[model samples]
Target: MWKFYLFLLPIFGVNISGLYAKNDQKIILATYTYDTKDRIENLLPFADLLKSRFEGKFEIETKSFPSVDELILAMLKKEVDLVFISTAGFLSYIDQADEFEIAGTLMVDQESESTYRSIIAASKLSGINSWEDVKSKSKGLKISLVNENSTSGYLLPYLHFQQRGLTPFKDNFGLVEFTGNHKKSLDSILTGEFDLAAFGENDLQNLSGNEDLIHILWVSPAIPLGPVMVRKDMDKSISEVVEQNLLNLHQSYPAILESIKAGWIEAQNASHFEKLTKDFYIDFLK
Candidate 1:
């Protein structure tokens, strides 16, 4: 029997002693990444631009990590004051932080009513023609997924499989590898290294990939991109300033949006991003 368990992963980051100690004049913001070596560097100019909005009241420091675990640990230690994290982390890891407060959602633009979705993709090498083929033969199937901390890449797809009676990489699939990011997951499929890949649909349209050789077996609902998170305990004035800037990023600070390839949007009809998370009950044989 399969269940849709709430996604809670174990910690994998090493403890950095005294990380919480920082200069009082500096604020730290972080994001998790894999293979985007320049992500941190790209964020620097954005941080500088954001700092400019603070009127010399404080400085912004941007950092990137290869693992969500490390990012979360930094948050726990109060070393990271703000974050641009994935939806999965927002849903499952919020309680891990004492002051986590969602400030805004990251969108393609202010007018992007709908966000990205997840897909179960297969490459030509899999010899799987369609959804039925995957459903019938997914057992022992070699699947490639992004890191466990990803929402579209892992969590949504995890529920998609369980709701349909298939739990790959846990009980049924032969091989399941974490490719680190959406592009890498897609790449793994194209290279014929796996029978299936689970990732965001946005990558299919935005990324330059051999789409002709891939087959879409399934697609999850519009799981919005990650949100901008801030520690509620942060200085009230600074927090208010950061929140306002993020909400108006597309219109007020287009340069920051251009640098990151996306802008922030206020949740159109909601006070928070509660709908972005899925409740699961998977029992992972612990």
Candidate 2:
């Protein structure tokens, strides 16, 4: 009878293991990039580093979308466990604030904090100088933005107009257009297709030969950069593990550090986003 009971216990243990396997949870990491195919490939190094360091305790899957709004919707539905989003993308989902928590932020250029400037660049021929000069000369002109949801490209620059006592859509800010990416925005501005465009400081600094054709008309103050976040419903223990590993990734993998262009910083909560939100509002009211 004792042998029979021992055998039964083993059978029950197998059943439980099967059940757990069937319900195994998968972690989905989402990013906002139209070219997800390439982006995911680029992110593989970091993902592999996490897996190696964690010893495959968690499974990670990555997906990319074209816009922040789409990714936010996924987060709301609990379809994504984690995300890499820009400052503007973060703000767009502020109402669902409780749905997520920041896990980490990339420290690009060895800076503990990352900030972007809304640069108003114009072709040398355009002769654009100051903000007032841009306002006066840009009437009926063409302008390009990285995207409608872009912080430096759209939100900050739009708010800049309001600060100057002008309306973005109603005021004579010219035919506003979306260039899809910062490089494209710069291209449009340099090719004479658009008089000027807004870009992050990183993009401006990375520009090569075209630097001669394009000039910065104005620049906004530094604003918060990208953040890595996790869904609120995720396991706290797992989140902490992921965060700690990433924050220390540069120390572990020299290759990953070079590829990502920054080390991981400790994560912050919603309060970290408040300053960015306030900056947007102040710009909006302006």
Candidate 3:
């Protein structure tokens, strides 16, 4: 199981610093959706910040799971100390509330109250110029999608298609591939290997750094970003420090906040997640 877990992580690129916790107090930060080396790199500074904030009381290690289920398993087994999961993944795993607590939710920008979009992009050469070209009237276009468990990458797009009175597999697509990561889906479409790709809007910006590469097809409605969840049984002193630091990240470490697409919010306060159901993503979630 350990070997399989290690194998699930992508090849190393970022150098995660700090000495291993000597008192069995190491903090393992874990995630599953949209895993990439670049994302790891972006989180490195944040890890270092955590190390500094902990004042030698804890160490930080980052891990990537192969799926949301695996991540939940790790949490249940008390292996992963914390998690950065999507809203969809969070809703799915929060049923095990006995094992975890919401540390904080990621705020996508400096101004917004907390919402972001899933973007659909089409290759300029694909002749899919606008939303009209993607409507039910057009069919047989090849598309690449991120994992079914991805909120922005998969669920939002699925919901959009459903509301349009158009079915993805049954109506207007010749091929649909769940490529499992934003980079592959975006790269495939940009290289003309696929006609369309859907992923997080921020992910697209992070990948290209600009919009000149691909034509924007459509943008889904705003979706709430997930929270940073921590293992409930973790040491209270360490968990409190981690939670407080995470909530103050915007001011304490703006660069890290920028890297993860957050501004500022009271992550420790109680939040009302009034509606969450498999209904939003019934086909796969069920």
Q: lDDT at 268 for candidate 1?
A: 27
Candidate 3 overall lDDT versus native = 0.65
lDDT string for model 1 (149-259, tens) is 877889888888887778645677778888887888888888888889998776787556577778888876566666678886665555655666666566655566555
Off by over 4 Å in 2: 1-23, 34-38, 52-54, 108-116, 209-212, 262-286
Ranking of all candidate structures by their lDDT, best first: 1, 3, 2
All predictions: root-mean-square deviation over Cα? 11.2, 8.7, 10.8
The global C-alpha lDDT for each of the candidates, from Candidate 1 onward, is: 0.65, 0.64, 0.65
| lDDT by residue for model 2 (114-203), tens | 445678788776777567677677676778888877888888877776677656553676688888777788888788888878877767
What are the TM-scores, per candidate, against the unseen true structure? 0.74, 0.74, 0.62
Least lDDT summed over 10 consecutive residues: which range in candidate 2? 266-275
Candidate number with the higher lDDT (2 or 3): 3
Query: Which candidate do you rate higher for TM-score, 2 or 3?
Result: 2
Better of 1 and 2 by lDDT: 1
Sorted on TM-score, highest at the top, how do the candidates line up? 2, 1, 3
Pick out the ten consecutive residues of candidate 1 with the lowest summed lDDT: 1-10
